[model samples]
Target: MPVGLSMRLISLLIVFLLLLPSTEMKRPGKGKGLKGARQNLAPGRVRVAGRHSRSRSSRLVRLPNCSESTESGEVFVDCQDQRLTSIPASQMWLKEPKHLLLARNRIRVLNDMAFRGYESLTSLDLQQNQISLVEEGAFQGLTSLTTLLLQHNRLVTLSEEALIPMPSLRYLRLYDNPWNCFCPLDSLIRTIQVPSNRKLGNHARCAEPITLKGIKLKQVDPELLCKESDPTGDPMEDQRDSTNTLKPSPIRSKPDAIAACHTYFFPQMRMDCRKQGLTEVPTGIPEDIVHIDLSHNSISHLKARDFQGARSLRTLNISNNNMEHIDTGSLAGLLHLRELDLSDNSLLFIQYGVLEDLYFLSQLNLGGNPWMCNYSIHYMVYWLRLHPAVRHSGLLCHSPLEHNGESVEEYVNSYNRECPKDRQHSQIDQDTDPELWQTVMEVQREVEEELEPSHLKAPQKYQIIRLS
Candidate 1:
């Protein structure tokens, strides 16, 4: 009896173990479902870098966040504003891409053999990047490339060997960089200055050796650049690595003004760059901008043609800044300007011809400034006198103890009585209205004749009259 019972118990235990294994297999696995949920591998959605243990094949697909599109039967890979550190050509370039745009990235160097397989590419945009070094063989395999944009970088010069590979290249942009204007830049400058390369380096200018600063590469004489050695010695600038062919200058290439500043289309086409700490006015402002607020900055001077492109601007606020001087013709293009603010600045006076371009200006704010009521201040007052319709204020004296705390108008009146200026100056000279002055003189003569001839001569009195 004991043997039979023990044998039956062992048979029941084997059956129970087999049933448990089959039951677990038939039921759904929770871990597998959660893994798929975390990846979210849905179709038509863009994928980002993931923390999952990737396969060897997937590691080669670490491309920038891009959205593919087709135009004119050509494939375009736009990776703008991706915060990318390197070009996507070597990592995940398409087979037959015609355009590979990587604008506004953080790419700082272009090593040799960079775009090895990009032979079919026609246009490559590298503008608005922080690229400092571009080795000689960087464009080795780009035989079909036509357009290359390198504006807004930190390149002091470019080697001519880099251009030898790109024979089919036609359009190039190298503006907005701090060009060193030294011996190494001679070959590149001479190449681009040729009439055949008209569109190559249009607006690129030198930034070092103060004499050559602000001079365009096209206008510079290539023969003279290398003719003189380091006459000025090494430039007093940030020291760079000695191994580089061309020194990487300080990054002064300004970003796109429309992108750096805030733009609003509704109500009015305006750009608000208030408190941006801009030392100089940025270029490439949209031509359609109507109002611009550049107040609360560190701009100490306004260069000539600063507002050259903003022809449609109506209101300009440059108040609350360190503006001490505005070059002649600085505001040369604002033909439609209606209002301007110069309040709360370090200006002692306004120079002549600075406001000559604002033909239709109506309101001008000059408050909160320390205007010195000197002879140089006459141009501003004369301009206001001619444009009587312009509503303006803040013309007060802040120096010359005798004229301090007095309105500029009162000081002008006193100065005219004491030390008069010429009539052509638009000053309120008595000679402007000859009839009025002649009548006063005749009345005084008649009074003198009646008093002195009849009895004792009484002293004639004349009152100083003020005119605008």
Candidate 2:
């Protein structure tokens, strides 16, 4: 009887032990479900690293609290397309994100210390926003930043000392800003004249004086301010008459006469007329000219006839000359041309839609010319970005913004300042009409030539007169 009772007790004990193993297995599954529910409640936590430990194949480590403070060099913040208005200040607490993109948002102002405390940040993108103002010291603490993009904004003026703290900053973009062409923007204009630097604009003319339109800042003569129409006589008055008579005026020169050169040269033309001091665009470039180089000359203006007959022309270079403007009708026939260069000259303004006809053009050289960072310059910036195939070489900004005061390349990049519209409109002289205003700017530029800081000496006899 005792042995039977013992066996029955032992059987009961074995049954309970077996049930315990099954219950333990069931608890793990139940815990998993609860954990999954918690994860659903905190989606941002799932985005953190290590939550996807099940996927051993994925190497991307989730960052701990994207907005939380981190120990340097541990994470990345991809806030692109998030429709953000301002970058959350908590980002400064992140442990050195390698890349931070804040593109496509409504960010308007970038305050000082906007990106403070993150020492290991390398790349930052603030492109495609409505950013209009950038306070001084905005980019102060980003020492490791290499590439900074701020394209497509409404910047009008940049102080000289704005970008002094960004020593590691390499690529800076302030394109597509409505730069106000005025005295306030002169420093920014001078900043873009450095090497590896580029800008997108036609010219930086004086917006205050009617006579300074289309005149590049490099060509501006502060002395012209003293040359207000002399009571005795104007020195440039006779120079103007001489210059006009030398050219078969744009209106007087027949389109056919210009086309005559096109017929003689036929499909392939190579005319050597360099250093001739020629004062006008050569007539009759062949309709199918493959290459036409008229460099190192004294040509002062560009007319519609310049490229009228060149239907199949591929390359045209007009460098090292004095040109004040790029008319809309000029170079209208370059349908198949791939390369065009206009460098080292005096260009005051690049009118809107002037290069609208260049469809297949791939390479465009416009360096060694003054590029003003003003509102009137936005047209060129927008156009260049629209056509990716077209390459701009030797482009430099002559503005002196305090942020990028020493660097020239930073001028073309995205920034929060630009030149003004009054610099292009609202003529600086007494004449209010557009035509007369244009004339005043032109004449004033010449009057101020004596004030230019070049090796060429100005005539000492000329009395002081203000061009404005």
- All-Cα superposition RMSD per candidate: 14.3, 27.5
227-267: candidate 1 lDDT, tens digit per residue: 53445665422322221224324475654464356554323
- What ranges in model 1 sit over 4 Å off? 1-60, 90-95, 229-468
- Ten-residue segment with the worst summed lDDT in candidate 1? 236-245
Question: What is the overall TM-score of model 1 with all chains considered together?
Answer: 0.43
Flag regions of model 2 displaced more than 4 Å. Answer: 1-40, 44-76, 89-95, 195-468
Residue 224 shift from truth in candidate 2, angstroms: 9.1
Residue range 87-203, candidate 2, lDDT tens digits: 754333324466676766788998888876555677677867888888878878777876666655677666556666766766566544565544566565665444444431213
Could you give me the TM-score of model 2 versus the true structure? 0.33
